[model samples]
Target: MRSLCLLFVTAAALSGCASVRTHQGYLTDPQLVASVQPGVDNRASVERALGRPTFMGQFDNNDWYYVGRELAQVAFGNPKPKEGTMLHVRFDPAGNVATAENLGLTRVVSIHPVGDKTPTLGRNRNFFEDLFGNIGQVGSVGQGGGTADNPTGGSGSN
Candidate 1:
């Protein structure tokens, strides 16, 4: 009985540490991708060799991208990228492959957003000040036509 319990505990611990791999986008096969020759292959030929691309360029239609990502997650933690590939294919005006670039995960750039606080123009105010600053002042609920003397209406004189 003790041995069985020990085995169960060990299995549970190991299970929690096991990583799950998640794949996103197209996976480029090295050998197949290598078959594409710049200046020789066109859009249709490249598609036949490497399958459909993951996405196309935003502003232009000549650039094609085949992006692939592999992420691993353990337990309930967020998945982290382990490997990735971005294959960029640019076609010339003649529709022939002009350039081919295979970028790896090392080329990725990560931008972290600013913290919770947002900076505004005026001086900083506390919670009470924010809630009660306009308590005594009066104005139309959502309108901005209020004046100093007539807080809820347009300027008194036309």
Candidate 2:
């Protein structure tokens, strides 16, 4: 009886171990997705089957979005992706399916590139001048103190 109980407890504990989940959260079944006729599957029907979208673009109103994000909650930790799926549904002028693109992690493009500089048209200004220009007497050639000739507000101690 003792041996049997030990075996049962071990089996139970082993069965309780967490198994990583895959292919259940995002990215609907490829076969099922392929079966969906773009225009035939109305907006409400998709929502009923696939829940809410992750996001909806404003300027590009034609495209509807569905996103999944995962971040680690612990401090001093590395966050890993739990599950992410993107469904970009594009509609034509007649409200027909222009395309239903399933973009996954492989398809995602990092908008932030390394050493990427913001495009600028105007000339750059002096950094110190731009930062501390207004802190002190900027008009006095940036020199400390002022001459007696101009005493309106040279001391800067109003």
Measured by TM-score, the strongest candidate is: 1
Best by lDDT: 1
TM-scores for every candidate against the unseen true structure: 0.73, 0.44
Worst 10-residue lDDT window for candidate 2 reads: 69-78
Q: Which ten residues in a row have the lowest lDDT in candidate 1?
A: 140-149
lDDT of 2: 0.62
lDDT of 1 by residue, 41-155 (tens): 9999998899888889999989999999999999899899899999999999989999999899977887778998777886588999779877746645347665444566655
Clashes of each: 0, 2
lDDT of 2 by residue, 76-141 (tens): 344446556677877776655577887767665656566767767754668986786556455664
Flag clash pairs in model 1. none
Instruction: In model 1, state the lDDT of residue 85.
Output: 95
In angstroms, what RMSD does candidate 2 have relative to the true structure? 10.2
Segments in model 2 whose C-alpha atoms lie over 4 Å from true places: 1-35, 69-75, 111-158
Query: Where is model 1 more than 4 Å wrong at Cα?
Result: 117-158
**Model 1 lDDT on a 0 to 1 scale:** 0.86
